[model samples]
Target: MHIELKYGNRKLQGEIPFDAQLLQPCIPPPAENPALQVHRALDRPLAVAPFEQIFSAGERVVIVTSDITRYTGSEIYLPILVERLNACGIADTDISILIALGIHRPQTEAEHRKILGPLFGRIKVFDHACDDPAQLVELGETSAGIPVAVNRRVVETDRVIVTGTVGFHYFAGFGGGRKGLVPGVAARKTCMASHFSVFNKAPQTGKHPQATAGVLDDNPVHHNLLEAARMVRCDLLINTVLSPQKEILGVYAGELEAAHLAACEQVQDLYQPRTERVDLAIISSGGEPKDINLIQAQKALDYGCRAVREGGTIVLLAACRDGFGHEHFYPWFDYQDLAQFEAALRENYQINGQTAHSLLSKARRFRVIMVSEFDAEITARMGMEKARDLQQAIDMAHANLSSMPKTLVIPDGGLVLPHQFVKVKTFADPA
Candidate 1:
C-alpha cells in the first residue's frame, strides 16, 4: 500500500503492508473561511462582554501571544484582533504585544516579524524573558505554593488579552486557556514550579498519574496553571482549535477558563480515535516543526505508546532537524543504566529532565525505533535504534514481533489519541 506522511514542508511517500491500520485525526472539513470565523468569534465573545464594552479608551493593553515554537498562526489573527482593539479607541501606542516565550529560546527579529506579519511595523512587540528578573512582577503565590511572577508589562497593563491555538498538551491536559499565563508570561521560577508538579518522587515508574494526556479533573499541573491565571485576572482569551494541517476548525473567545474548557470538549472528539491494542505501531509526529526536534517529537511517541500493547514495537518518523530542542536534555541520555538515571533524576530533577525519564519509561515497555536526521551514535545514546529509512525502520520493527503482528499506522500521532476499550463477555446456553 502506498501512503504519504507529513515531513517538514513536504510529504514523504512509502509503501507499507495493506493490513496495517491507518489511524488519523477525525478532523472535519475545513471552515469555508477561517479568517472570517475568527473575526466573528471576536465580535461575539463567549460568556463575556465584547471587546468594545470590556475596555475603555486610554487603557494600556497587553496582547499575549505564543512564541514561534507554538504554531498559533498569529499573523492570521493578530492583525484582525488589533484592528478590533483599535476600533475600541485603544491607540497604537497604548497597546503592546508580548510573546509568551516561557523558558524556550527567544525568537529572532525576522521570526517575530513573520509571526506578527504587518503588525510588526506598527505595534511595539517584545518577547518575554523568563530568566530576566527585572522583567517579571511578583503576583503572590497560589494556595498550592506556585509563586506567580508574570511579565511586568502584563501586570502593569490595564487590560490583558491572550491569543493562542488549542491542542492536546502531553502533560497539562490541553494547551491554550490559562497556559498563556502560567508558562506563557510567567517568570522562570513560576514556570518551573508548575512543571515540577508533573514529577513523581519515584522517577522509575515513568508515568505521573495526574499528568497523563486528555485528563484534567485530577491533573495537578493543569489545576495549578488555572489558579495562576485567575490570580492575575486575565480579561479575555482567544483560542483556536485546528486540524492536523493547522487549519482553524473552531474559534473560542471569552472568559479564560470557560471558553478554553468549552473548546477542549468541542474539539477533542476530532482527535481521539477508538482502537484496540496493537503489537506494532508506525507513527509520525505530525511532521515539520512538531517534529522539528527529537525532544518536541517525543509527544508522538507517548501517543503511540497508548495504542501499542505491552512489549510492542513503535517505529517513529520525525525530522528532528534542530536536534534535541533543549540543551539540558542531551546529557540525560549519557546515563546508560536506567536505575542510575532514575536515582539521579530523583536527586536533582530539572525541567526538560522529565523528557528523558519519559523516553526511558516508554522504552522499558516497548521497543522504540527512531527514523530521523540524528546520527546513529546519537540515536543509540538516546536508547533508540536508528533507521536508515522508513522501510528499514518497519523491517526492524517487524523483526521484533512474533509473526505478522497486528499493526497500526498513525499519520499524526501527536493529535490522534487512541481511546481505551472495555471488554464484554457473552454467554450461551446449549440445548
Candidate 2:
C-alpha cells in the first residue's frame, strides 16, 4: 500500500506491505466553534467556581502558558481567556501573559505574536527566564525536598491561571496541569531537582519503572512536580486536548489538578489505541513544529516503539530542521555506553541528557532507521541508522528483517500511543 507521512513541513511517500497495520489516534472532529468551547469550559468548570466568580476587578492576573515548542491552540484560546478577564471588570493593564519557556530559549517577536494572538499588544507578555535569579522567587520546598522556585511575576500575581495542552508525556506522566507551573516557569535548579526524581535513589541507579508514558500514580517525577506546583497558589487551570490536526477537540477548566486530570482522561480516550505487536513499525513525528528538532521528535519514537516486538525495526521519519533541540543535547550522545551514561547522568543530570539516555537506550534495543535531515555519521553517533528518505528507510527495514515481517505504520506518531494487547489465558478450574 502507498502511504505518505509528514516530515517537517513536507510529506514523505513510500510503499509498505498490503497487510501492514496502520496505527492512528481516534480523533473526534474538531469543535465547531473552538472559542465557544473554551467559554463553555470556563462556565462549567470541574471542581471549582467559574472564572468570573474567582477573579475580582482589583486583582492582578497572570496566565501561564506553554512555550513555542509545544503548541496548545494558544492562539484560539488566549483571546477568549483575555476577553473573559475583561468581562470580569479587570482591565487589560492588570493582566499579563507569561510564556512558560522553562529552560527553553526565548521566543522571537514573531513567536510571541503567534502565542498571544489578538491579545499581543493589548496585554503585556513576558518570557520566563529560568536562569535569571532576579526574576525568580523562592517558594520553600516540596515534602520530597525538591526546591521550589518560580517566576516572580507569577508569585506576585493576585490570581494565577495555568494553561496548556494535555498529552502523553514520556516520563512526567502527562503534560499540562502542574507542568505549566513547575518546569514551565520554574528556576533551572528547581527544574533539574524535580526531573531527577525520574531516576531511583542511590544503589538502584536506573530509571524508576513507574516514571513513564501514560502513568501518573506512583510516578515519582509526576509526584515531585505536583508537589512543587502545589507550593505556588494557582487560582484556576485551563487545559485543552488537541486532535492530531492541531485542532482543539476538548477544553478542560477549573481547579488545577482536577481540570488537568479530566483533560488527561480525554487524552487517554483519544490517543491510546490497542494493537498486536509487530516486527516492524514505520512512524512519523507528525510535522513542522513536532519535527522541528531531534529532542522534540524523540516523543514519536518513544510512543511508537511500544507497538514493535523485541529487537524489531523502527523507521522513524523526523525532519529535525532545527537540529538538536538544545546545544547541550548533542554532547550527551558522547557517552556511548549505557551504564557509563547512567552513571554520568546520576552524577550531574540535565533534562536533555535524560532524553539522550532514553533515545540511546531505545536505539540499542531496536534497529532504529531514522529518515531525517541529520547526516548518517551524526545519526550513527546516537546509535541510529540514517536514511535519506522514506523509501530508502522502508527498503532498509526490509533488508534487516529475516522474513516478510508483520508491520505497523503510525502517521501521527507524536500524538498517538499504541499499546499491545496481551491476551491472558484463563484456565478452566474445578467446575
Question: In lDDT terms, which candidate is top?
Answer: 2
**lDDT (10s digit) by residue, model 2, range 126-241:** 99999999999998888888888999998888999999999999999899999999899999999999999889887437899999989999999999998899888899999999
Model 2 lDDT at residue 61: 95
Error of 1 at 231 (Å): 2.1
lDDT of 1 at 79: 89
TM-scores of the models, in the given order? 0.93, 0.96
Cα-based lDDT for every prediction: 0.81, 0.89
Best by TM-score: 2
Candidate 1 global TM-score? 0.93
Tell me how many clashing residue pairs each candidate has: 0, 0
Residue pairs with clashing backbones, model 1: none
